[model samples]
Target: MTVRISAPSGPFRDAGIEALREGLTRRGLLGCGAGAAGAVLLGAAGDARSQDAVQPHALAEFFQGHQVAGAALSPSGERVAVLLNIGEGGARRMAVDLIEAADPSGPRRRVPVGDFDVETLAWANEQRVMMRLVIPVTAGGNTPTGRGIANRTYELQSRRVVSMDLETGETALMFGDERVRMRESLNLGHIVDYLPDDPDHVLMAAREFSGLMALHRVNVNTGRADLVERGSQLTLDWSTINGVPVMRRDISTRGSVINIFVRPDGEGRWRRAWRQPTAQVALADFIWIGAAERAGHALVAARIEDEDVLAVRELNLDTLEYGPPMASRAGLDVSASLVDARGRYMAAAFYAPRLEYDFVDSDLGAHHRAMNGFFGNECNVVLANADAAHNRFIIRASGPRDAGSWYLYDKAARHFEYLGARTLLDTRRLAPAEAVQVATRDGASIEAYVTAPPGGAPGPVIALVHGGPESRDVLGWDRQAQVLAAQGWWVVQPQFRGSGGYGLAFASQGWKRWGDRMQEDVEDALAQIIRDRGLDAARVGIMGTSYGGYAALMGAVRRPDLYKAAISICGLGDLGDALAYERRDDESADGFVYDYWTSRIGDPRTDGDAIAAASPRLRAAEIACPVLLVHGVDDPIVQVHQSRGMNDALQAAGKPVEYVEVPGAGHADWEDDVEKDLMERYVALFSRAFA
Candidate 1:
């Protein structure tokens, strides 16, 4: 059963930023704490309130309401650990609350986890929880060496993992040791499995001295680790089943190759199961949905030869073959699978317009359908966590307008009790995002999302390109788009050719076409939106972060007449400089970053002319409109130098440009104050350009 809510009426009421802040305070959205007070104080100090006194909503409100942070369910299903951002401004900090599952509104206890920011959390057992920490690192002239797993060239200062004993209120670092000299190192092994049978130990993938990742059996309580499986020299990634490492991947210039190894009877010599390329591996790929009761067989999500979408199937490990489909969707990819405590595939989820689930287990499906009916599907529902018995679980529902809420589902009583919302916001005021398709000049259909102001009438549009030209935009409550809409600007997010989530054919088209076809797709979206919605052609502007930022600058250089103004946040300027930096930082001569970039973005060493032509810094003189450059001083991914170089080049050309350098901000870490300031600057700059 699926329920859909009506699209919001006209844009939200044009209340001033002050009124928005006051409303948040009156509604207790901003807690009564020093951190909250600091945030308010910081906002008061800003000129945002003075710049646009009659503007509806404060930028701070949007930022505050959008952050629910993280949540996890206990193995016993008795308690839920929720991580929320409390306090405001620089004083704001992340706090974890242990709430009772039965009585969510009842008094809860705060877990003292210390100063570091918690990135993610999971249950080690009913009495223990594991947490990954995001520690701040100072920016200097330090160049990271070697490509880390996943072709990551820029390394964070520190990423540590630790375990907390809820019973004793004690926590210990999981990776700190005398043997390992953790200097500028990406420490804290990645958790593979909790090993439910052995609560004291968890399977982790830790980086060894050989620059290869090896599997280890880590003791959560003692921080002692024993090597379980050693990685080969070419091992790029690995997967395990029932706590046993069975598959390893080697990524090469050609493509990914998988090696499947099996151990019979849980002991003796490990023998080869099978080997295949990514295309063949996709045929019978094993998904780590759960620990199967049957040793050599597990639930898998795979794509058949003729199918465009993935299907849920039972995979035979011994023979590397797939059985009949358990659940298959026509056009949508199978997103995830739900397994019961007994290791049985109970449900499968797929996303068509929004997320929809099918029950493979009749009993569990019926119960979930009933729960959905009771909950009322105004928002998409997700099963966050469940206990072994499948009798109790945590359900999170969220939509494009709604921030989201958590609920506890009791299977025995067939009851769903309200927990708490991540934030309290007036949904009526938020604009609804509509999925759209635009035909490019080359006749390729590009998937895009457009969020218009209250009325259907078009106005000044902001071409908000998404970062990760590799990542695609989906339907959700986008805070940035909402904030822009509240200020009366239409936001168009285009999923250019190279973006993921559509299909291999669609994504593969983006490779090595960064500035050429990729930029064309973005421009085509803007032109199509103008024609379709009758938007003001002269008032269109382009802005983005990272790759999106790169696109913004490139658009201004390549098609200055199309965009009225441009903004680039942490964007790359020179392709040559970026590739050179990667080559210098990477210890491996033929590393993944060097090879991947060479294929996807063109090699600076060999394809120097093409790279130079696409570089925004080199073509700065061609930009005719005003440009806003914003970058974090401590950004590791695309260094601060990128923005500085572009700013210098523009200044040398006597072009209209403004630069803002955010202190102590990394690639992904933006302070509340910094974001608020940027929002205000955007409004001021764009308003002037449009006027």
Candidate 2:
């Protein structure tokens, strides 16, 4: 059997993602594409897309196998480290594979990772590989959750750092064998800084059973972590110089208020540098993106007193003063910087929905630009990693047609070898997405993607809202959106104000808006699409996952006249229950996640009226259209009860509803068969609704 798998481009990049991304781009997507997936997949069928006709598996192909999300090159550039889809049918999972960079088809070592999924990869050296992995945890009866033995309890995702030896393929959890509570604060991985200069050690923050995240210098090979500095209860992450912790960023336990502190050296007294609020939904502190060109000067992210957006500044590490602006995006916040093997800043990067870099290193910058141009500049091209000599390189690219693919570049040879595509493609049905800027009711314009079948004209429309409330949809190859487009419906993904990456004024206002302005934002975007495309507004429907799912349900209740149908997947039905659930399962009362939610969303204890007003389950009868609610039975984040209760409420109200609880599925991801089932149900629901 031949199996094809691909990568994930996301609305929610997860914890420390910006750091991981910038680090990997400097070192290693689907690692950021076009040759062939030379990697092997176990127990898979023939090419479903190769059939003359559009097979039933065209959409199902998305769920069939896992794909490589990203990859990196070894320090010596001798081998490539990337996770690939490897397992039997339906149960397929991601595992690490070390293949010779110069000879991928030659000798290789496969590291079986069991059920855990590899999120990102780096190298301790040429022989040892390090990774950030998320291991699924199912909490139940008689557990620390304090739930009844009869109650099924589970945590959303349990993330940890793991290291593997290429010689023996032995893997160990880098944090040690301590059994800590599931609800560790984001600081556990909040600031994972991979040291480019130090080959054997990676600096990160980890939490104990209680207290603030302490800085640890972890040995990449021995799985030994040495405590470097213990932080305060509010300490989020620390900045370092020559392996010594010198600065730190601390956030208020209950709100978005953040404090920045720094010292003259590792042992100096800490003093306040500044205070800032998370005014942006996707706020990133790139204060020290990379090492500066000159000694004693480091590249830092700073916002001038009068400026609204952050820019790149050469920070004087000694006096702690900002130098002149090195790069600014005018209105957008700078999120990351590109540094090469020599520890030189190549470019400054920000999410323009697509990654746009302000190149400082002209030679490498031109090479990157040329790569993008070669792919028509319509796709995202990233320089994944490079050798110390800066000769061999890894390149990744993804587009509307291509899910994602990797290429090996022999810079000295001026050659690129296609490694493989990230996702399994149904070439016969792949669709293109056009980025559209639509205006909200408040007269503010937001970006959205309008996806359609090949040469497809606007007709029946489906609004695809992204989750994360703070998570923003990007202009990338999205499988679900593409599948919906293959169904012959114009799928429009709205980057609502609550969504991030736009700017301050755009996302800040939507923080507490929930079913109010947030719902209105989706409504406004859909209305604009209908008007601009001259499509039948009556046939429009709304759907999403997590927070996106909540918006869909609210769409049915708020504007039944506009949306004829709705689909909510693992969505929150009651805001109050969600808050209570998090609080109950919380390992630390000071966790910013619980506090972040309450700060943006009012505390359910005190804001019952507002909570009830926005809850879809609380107002089930208000919905006039047929609704579909799909949730993972083992989902620990939003909990399956949220959907079940909504189902019961709709049934009691005599409203049409369909509900499904997928067994063994969790909030973060689903198994292959489960994903296939989901696609089928989604298509069936839309078919009946629009017919």
Candidate 1's displacement at residue 533, Å, is 4.7
lDDT of 2 by residue, 467-569 (tens): 8776677677787887787777888888887765555566677866897888887887778878887877879989999889999998898987888889999
Quantify how close model 1 is to the true structure by its C-alpha RMSD in Å: 9.5
Please state the error at residue 589 of candidate 1 in Å: 10
Best by TM-score: 2
Quote each prediction's TM-score: 0.71, 0.72
What's the distance in Å from true for residue 669, model 1?
Answer: 5.3
Query: lDDT, candidate 1, residue 680?
Result: 87
For candidate 2, the TM-score is: 0.72
Q: Tens digit of lDDT per residue, candidate 1, span 20-54?
A: 33322223121111111121121232222322333
Per-residue error for 338 in candidate 1, Å, reads 4.3
